[model samples]
Target chain A: MKYLTYILRNARRNPARTGLTIASIAISMFLMMILTSFFAAMQEANSASRQYNRIIVMNANGFAGVVPIARVRQIAAMDGVVAATPFAWYGGKYQNQRVLFAQFGVDADSVFDTLEEFHLPDDQLAAFKADKAGAVVGPKLAREYGLKIGDAMPLQGDVYPVDLKLNIHGIYESPRNSDQRMVLFHHDYLDDQLRLLGPSSSSGSSATQPSGRAGNAGIVFVRCKDAAATAALCKKVDDEYRSTDNPTRTQTEEAFGQMFSEMMGGMKDMVFWIGCAVVVSLLFVAGNAMAMAMRERTMEIAVLKAIGFGKGLVLTLVLVEAVLVAGLGGALGTLGSKALFDLFDVSPYTGGFLPFFYVPWRVALAGLGVSLFVGFVSGVVPAVMAAGSSVVDGLRKVV
Target chain B: MSAPPSIELRGVEKEYRRDEFVVPVLQGLDLSVADGEYLALMGPSGSGKTTLLNLVAGLDVATRGQVIVHGQDLGRLSEGQITRWRADNVGFIFQTYNLVPVLTAAENVELPLLLTKLSRKRRRENVATALRVVGLEGRERHYPRQLSGGQEQRVAIARAIATDPFLLVADEPTGDLDRGTADEILELLEQLNREFEKTIVMVTHDPLAARRAGRILHLDKGRLVDDVINDSAAAAG
Candidate 1:
């Protein structure tokens, strides 16, 4: 009890240093929490969208572009391809806003049937089917465009030369996959638009030729009978398309997600380096604060030591004071970071890639653990110096 | 067992080496203090009065001889054992009061009792009794900073007697106080000596304070030069 009082009194004596130390700890913890939460949220979204039983076949050259719809059909006819859908890449700009988003033209029925994540209401589904030029936008994109159920959106395609007039048939939202903001239109609309804008059969060029179907569909989604059959099915599909004009690369849904994540190499490296630097800098700040506090309280520590307080007791007193300050700071920082997320919207506009900023529990727990460890590490040297001081010398010290 | 001599020093010597020189503080000094004796040591600055007092109080070590207090040789004990012996057998009153500034008078008085196996209620009772003995029961909650110099010294006295030790060792207990406060402290010490029968060995430079003791021992350098018993004290009815 005496030791506790002594610790509290000492902690109270230097309010400025203690407050600064706590602030440093809080900020570091908050940053760590934010970074970890951001990454973990991305992983959860990826995991939610990734269908393990499905196989995604892309260009063998490994890049984002169009593959022929004929190629998609061939891959669909392969064995173990219970269902397959052609998904074309449409990088579109809305109303010249300079904000880029994903747009995919799929066989809407087959897409809704094969990919379970594209869940929409029956009315919205019917609306999408009734209108040939109709499109469905993710909830975030719909909100950004201020589009209602019947709003007509003029979207400019980045790769194709056609400007599309798409009616907003429905708004799609998924807590996990809701981050994928895209406009999905009917594949027939794109195919007809291309035919209308191209040379006709009277010119001795078939409009339905492979060259005319160049941008028909760049990707195909194939679902195997079961998860265990996906690997063999992927190899079989790749082997079947290996001799075709447009060869294919097949991978499981998870591997495709990992490939997308690996695309942002620069951002991932920046996150790693920034995290390391922040933690190291915080440790230095915390260490300095503890050292200064210990130096200023030398006389008080000496007095306690002189009056029959054991060395261990004195050390514990100082360390407990540090831990109290740091732990309180960490808890406040975590809570404050959460509150900050609520009060201020800091979601990065990284080309519509992420949504819903948060602080993960693992990150919070790790931050707290680091704060405690820093408190102990920083206080140890100073506590030892105070405790090991000679009683006679301590008594002689004026301050 | 018989009543212990409270403090005993036999051929005790203290020496300090300065660079290449060996300086002796106490040279082969021998003394015995009775159970309830009130003794004072006085001499010049370089005299061994403080050194001898420290030896008797078990606060310092002897280079060549035994410092026995209440039948235990202080030289043979470990640091922890010596601290325990000091807490058990001797109390100290310093010139500076040495009260922890953060603690109240009552808490300061309760410090020595921490070394004892007394319960909290019993400790509180004993602290109250000690404060009453020093006439500071009314100011029990006053901090050291809140009290006057004289009041702080009285609190120090309360702390010294809190554990009911066999002996009290004071080094210039009145050195920092004014004449009136010094006289009050002296009266308190005399009362303790008379009423409680606590043997006291006080080191002082004040001749008047020295004159109040039952015996005054004068020293030059490190050896005792004069030892005299006060005739009035001996003849007191």
Candidate 2:
């Protein structure tokens, strides 16, 4: 601490070079902080999705293909099944803008039963079940689009080719992050709307709509007695429908969430590789700067040794200088990133892509640790060479 | 009965081995200086004046024989002990006046005192006193580049004496100064030795600078070839 001024003034010997080195470290550490935050958010969302022990029934092809709606009651009545709901994707655009939130047609009476994590007002639930056009949105969706009860929502359909006119009757809260970005309306309302788009009716659009797919269900969400019953229930349901016209495939909800995680696995791999590259590049940048500093101060180091500083003390000074540079950069990157997120509202830009996105304090701390490690490793070699240099050879410069 | 000589070199032989060749710099030699003596070593390049100074200052060790200063045999001290010994006992003045360019004049003088366990206030007082002794008290905040060569040398001298060491070894202390500034530096050295009783061993190529010392020894080919007693130096200062 006594020599801190000397070490710091030595760093300021080349202000531009030191500034650039710090900036580079800050930028890379900033990237690491963001990436770490994103992974945490992703994992948290996935963990939240697994709070209920449930299974999903979809057409054998995938969720893109629909299961028959008739399977709902049969699955609900199956042994070890608690409740079941038809969850059909209604990929519609709101106000002609492609707002990227999930729009699903679900059986209101049974969806809250199957996905037990969600809560809504009893009166709002009654209203949702009474009116075919009544809809309920998650809390985040309501906040994101500034939705309130009694507001009208007009969605132009692109998948089913049937537009929906829905009135906001309720806003639901959920423990799960992804669930907070969903809009669930009655599946029967969608079927009825599709019925009006028949060949005999000229109702919503002039474009020809696909026929005879009105009773399709994107998925039949089934809650089991517990996690242990999910696999057996899924197999029983799949086996029960194997001989039908629309053969079904089923899985535990956790497994279904893992499928989406697998999709993100590719992107996560890319991010991880990019993070590794940034660290390596930062090390080289910091190491080169330390080496250059050592070269410039060769005589200065010799003078320090001659004036009574031991070789260990000289080595420590150089290493500490390097660490200080990298540590400052790390602090700027990590703390600055956290502060930036705190200062801004980033959800509107995300379009509900990442729910509950946040940079944890632990991630910031880890980032700082990485920066310090980078400093230590980079400075060690240069410090050794500088400390080991002979005072006679160093004073040779004067001659 | 008087105090033994402050510095003693008995049969000191020094050599450097580079690429498997032993290049002898100092042959077996004997010399001594009294507690308050001011001595000058004059020689051409490669004449072992600087080598002898380094040995006497504990900056280097002899390949053979003993180099003693202030009653401690330097060759017997361990590496760390010798460094501590130098810090407590020997002060050095280089030809370049090697002040750290980034530090102010006062900071440069305070450099050596940092090795001691002195409190910050105590170190500051010592620095002020050393700077005052070298007549650089008011210029403590000035940097090396901002000061003249004569002033920079004064700062270096202040740094050397900051710990109040027993011995001072200056290798061409005024080599970079002009004739006028050189005389000023020589007089300052004379003051340190005269009024303060500092034992100074200076190496120089300039004959005029050599005459400023009480005794002068000229070296040729690693041996003392001429020894002269400059009786005029002590009277002038």
Candidate 3:
């Protein structure tokens, strides 16, 4: 107990240095905690975005191109294909405001019935089917645009020459990762609208022809009956479309997310390395603070030793001061991270990816553990210096 | 058949090395102090007066021979054992009054008692008694810096006696004080010796201070030159 008092007195003697050490420790620990939580959240979002059984059948080229609508039907009739829905990527500007979202034309009724994940309220579902130019926007998009039920919107096409006047029948909220921040409406309306906006007399292709260029949809989403049947079903579908007029490239959602993660190469490594650097720098700063404090108290330590304080007791007192500074700093950083979450709304990359932001309890615990370990590492040298000092020499030192 | 001398040194020597040569301080010195003896050691600078005090207090070791204080040979004891023995038997008063800066007068007095098995209440009682003996009962709560130089020395003396050690070793206890304060301090030491029968070995260069002791031993070049018993007139004046 007396030793604890001495430690407190020592720390209080240099409040500024102690406070700065604590702040540095706390801030770095908090950042590490936040980074780890983001990593965890990203892992969760990546897995959630791609369901194992759902296979995406896009053009043989990549995600940007489109496949014929005829191929979508053919893929749906395959052996393990429980259901298939065609998705057409329609590029358009909302009210010329440069607002962007995934404007997709899907067979609303069949797609909703086939994919168990696209869930909406019964009223919204009914309203979506009742109106011809009706659309159900993802909840995040609707919130961003202030679009409510029964509101009408004019969307100017970016790819095809057409203007889409659509009714916001209902807003859709989805737990599935793919359903976030998208706009889905009936495919028939887009197909009809595309014919009106295309050239009246093109050289070789007619707009009315079903197998022509106007009839092409972006991709076919094949929802498997059982998640385990994905590999076999995918193989069968690829083989059915092999050497056909238009070949298909099929992949699971996880593979798709992995491709995106791989695209952001060296970014992950940089963040990890920076985190390590921060920790190392913080360790040195904390160590220096403890050493300075120890140096200042040389006389007091000698006095204690001469008066009968054991070397072990003196060492413990110095270490306690260091640990207290570091531990409190770690706690402060963690609390600061939590307060940050309330003050700022962190959105995923601008119109590109969904960002995962959260602070896990494990990260907090690990941060505190690191702080304690660094405190110990920083304190040992000074503690040994104090313990090994000669009491006679120490007493002779004029304070 | 009488009890062994309270302290005995036989052929004790201390040396300090300079670059390549050894400078011997005390060479083959022998001395004995009996129980209840108030002995004053007077010497010029570099005559090894302080070194002798350190040897007696177990703060330093003799390069050769034995230093038997309270009938225990210091040379044979381990460092830890020597420390414990010093805490148990010796009280040191330095010229600068080395009381801990952080502690109050009472806390400084209670320091040596911390090494003992005494209860908190017993430690407090001992500290209070020691302070009262030095006539600083009301100054117990004051910090060392708040007191005058003379008062700080008095507090240090109170601390030395707090543990009730058998030997009080003072190295120029009145060296840094004014003449008036020095006289008062010498009077206090004489009172402690006569009233409590505490054996004191004081090392000082001041002849007037030496005259107050029951006996004075003068040293020159590490050799004893004079051993005189002071009469009543000399002791009082």
Candidate 4:
């Protein structure tokens, strides 16, 4: 406690060098946290999916292929299945701008059952089920676009032959951020338009095309009766469809989330290595600054020893000052990163992957730990050298 | 019964190893100082004056002989024990007034007392008393850079005496000061010796500075060439 003033004074001895070193560490740590946050987002997604025993049943070709809508009924009647719904992606444009929030043609009545986390009032849910054109927007999407219950949400088709004129009937709130950023309407309404406008009518793909993607579901979401039965049910569904024309692959919701992470697994490693490179670069920056600061204090250190300060005390003070500088920078970086994600909605920039990009306390703590480690590494050599140096030579060097 | 000398060196030989070669600085140097004695060392450059002072102050080890200060054999003590002994018994004043530039005068004075078990209030009181004794009562908050050359040396003296060590070893204590400031510093040293009875060993090149000491020893080529007793200087002090 008595030595704190001396240590802090020494840390602030050269304001320019200390500020530069701190800035270097802060920038490096911010970049590292940004990269780590990507993986944290994926983990958060999987963690949310694991809360319920849900399985995603997609066609063999994944999103490129569509499953027959009749399979939802067949899966719902399966032994361990509790509820099932057809979930299809609608690539649409709104107000001549690309829709940032996801638009999906979901079975409105059963989607509320499958995604039980989304909270909609009983009246709002009934209103959505009564009208085919009624749509429910997630709270996050409503907040982003200032959408109200009676707002006319018109979506121009990008992937289908017909457009949708949907009226927002409900906005769902969920504890999970990702689940509350989607727009879901009755699949029957979209199917009615798809059948009316054949493949060649509006999209002008081909005039003689006999078949279209009508009455097809992009994916089937199944809620199992028990969590432990999901793996077995996924295998049963995939094996049963293996020999059929419309083959399918079924996976637990968490596993489905992991599939996207696996797609980005190699990139995560690259980003991690880049973060490592950033830390290494900061090590040198901090090391050089510490070396210079220690060198400047060489004579004062000798004077301290002459006045009876032990080598151990000197070493501790030097290392502690280094850590103090680094810890301040780390704390600043965390605040900066948190403020950025908090003050602005990065949903528009994350490609809908991370709508709520708040940095977890664990990741912030990890960054601070890394800062302390860098401090210890960078200060050890110079501190040991300073403490172990000959006092006579040091005093005489300046004398 | 007579007490032992405050400092005694019996055939102390000090050498430095530079790579493989051995450079001898002090050879078979035998010296002793009675309690409360004021002595000064004078010599040309590379004459072992400062080396002998270092040996007596326990800053360096004797290569082949015994250096006993305050009745403890420094050569037999470990590094830790010698440091504690130095802190308890000896005070040092450097030629360059080596107070930490960042610390104020009071903080600099309080530095040595930090080694003791003294409470913070007591340490502050001791620092104030030390600074007061040096005639710098109101300058406690001034940094080394803020003070003049002589004031800085006075603050260094206050720091040296803050723990109330009985002995003070100063190497060229006034080397960087002007003659007026040097005289002021020398007078302060004489007052400390006459009033407080501190055993002071000083190394100086100025003849005028040496005259302020009760005794002066001249060294040349690693040997004590002459030891002079300045009775008038003792009387003057």
Candidate 2 recovers a fraction of native contacts equal to 0.45
DockQ of 3: 0.22
Stronger candidate by TM-score (1 vs 4):
4
The TM-scores, chain A only, for the candidates as listed are 0.84, 0.85, 0.79, 0.94
Leading candidate by DockQ:
4
* Backbone clashes in model 2, listed as residue pairs: none
Looking at model 4 chain B, which ten-residue stretch has the lowest summed lDDT?
Answer: B51-60
TM-score, structure 4 vs. true: 0.95
Q: Which stretches of candidate 3 lie over 4 Å from their true place?
A: A30-40, A44-62, A65-259, A348-354, B4-10, B16-26, B29-60, B68-237
**lDDT of model 1 at position B216:** 91
Question: Given candidate 1, what's the lDDT at residue A385?
Answer: 82
- Candidate-wise lDDT, in order: 0.75, 0.86, 0.76, 0.86
Which prediction has more favorable TM-score, 1 or 3? 1
Write out the backbone clash pairs for model 1. A67-A218
lDDT of 1 by residue, A1-399 (tens): 644655665666667877877887887778777766676656666676555478888878765434567666676676776777888765667888654567878877666666766678889988998888998887766766577889998878655656678898988765533444678888878777666666543234332342365455777887766787789978887787788766778898777777777777677788878877876776677767877887766655654554455577677877787777777788888777766775654443665555456665556667777777777777787778877876544544331
Of 1 and 3, the candidate ahead on DockQ is: 3
Model 3 C-alpha lDDT per residue in residues B44-162, reported as the tens digit of each score: 88787777877887877999989998779999987678777877887878788888666789988888887788888998899999999998989988988899999999999998888
TM-score of 1: 0.78
How do all models score by TM-score?
0.78, 0.87, 0.72, 0.95
DockQ of each candidate relative to the true complex: 0.21, 0.57, 0.22, 0.65
RMSD of each: 5.2, 4.1, 6.1, 2.3
When summed lDDT is taken over every stretch of 10 residues in candidate 2 chain A, the lowest stretch is A202-211
